[model samples]
Target: MVEALTTTIQTASLILAGWCLVSTFRDRPMLVPHLVAVGVLWLLVIAQAVVSAVLMSGGEGPAQTLMFVSYLVFIVLIPPACAVWGFVERSRWGPAVIAFACLILPVMLVRLEQIWNPAGV
Candidate 1:
């Protein structure tokens, strides 16, 4: 967990997700940029995972690899989940689901950071 990246990127994502939610409520299905923004958010997440894994994997410390994999699993799922749910619904609520998930990113990132650096935090 990259604390700075998590805080900054996730907060930015929250704003974008808020926009997506607002657009969902006020506009058509295709008008929202929720999927695109979520994709970008995942890019950051993947990067964070990769960096953490590489650092932890090389060291002699007791790094829990499964935790990183778990974060990746959920991080990877988020974009597609949002896309499918949002697309299938074909309604403002589609973006609403995405918006809700976007709002969750920061919290999840924070948790991930805590997992990585539990003692200090």
Candidate 2:
């Protein structure tokens, strides 16, 4: 895992979590801006996944390949699912849900990095 990409992903997720928190504090439902932010973040995650996959293909990966791929699939899934859940709920808690997911993202990415390069850090 590239440190730069990991930092980028972590930063993006933090920003997204901040946005969600602000919306939740204001008692606002999930809005278009939130969805758009999630979409952009999702794209970044996909890029990260692709890059990591390519690197892993070249054998630059952890021994637990199945576990790493499962994490990949999980991280790829959260944003869209939360977006849908947020939209469906249409309440302050919707943004809270998004905030929760965004919070999970960075931690998950950090774990992914560790799993990818256990000795790097």
**lDDT values, one for every candidate:** 0.71, 0.89
lDDT of 1 by residue, 1-121 (tens): 5568777778877887878767776965734456677677778877776777677777722255577568757865776677778778887677787787788777777766666666767
Candidate 2 regions with alpha-carbon error over 4 angstroms: none
Which residue pairs clash in candidate 1?
A: none
> What is candidate 1's TM-score against the reference?
0.81
Candidate 1 achieves a global lDDT of 0.71
Model 1, runs deviating above 4 Å: 30-32, 60-65
Q: Give the deviation of candidate 2 from the true structure as CA RMSD.
A: 1.0
Highest lDDT against the true fold, candidate = 2
Instruction: Please give the clash total of every predicted structure, in order.
Output: 0, 0
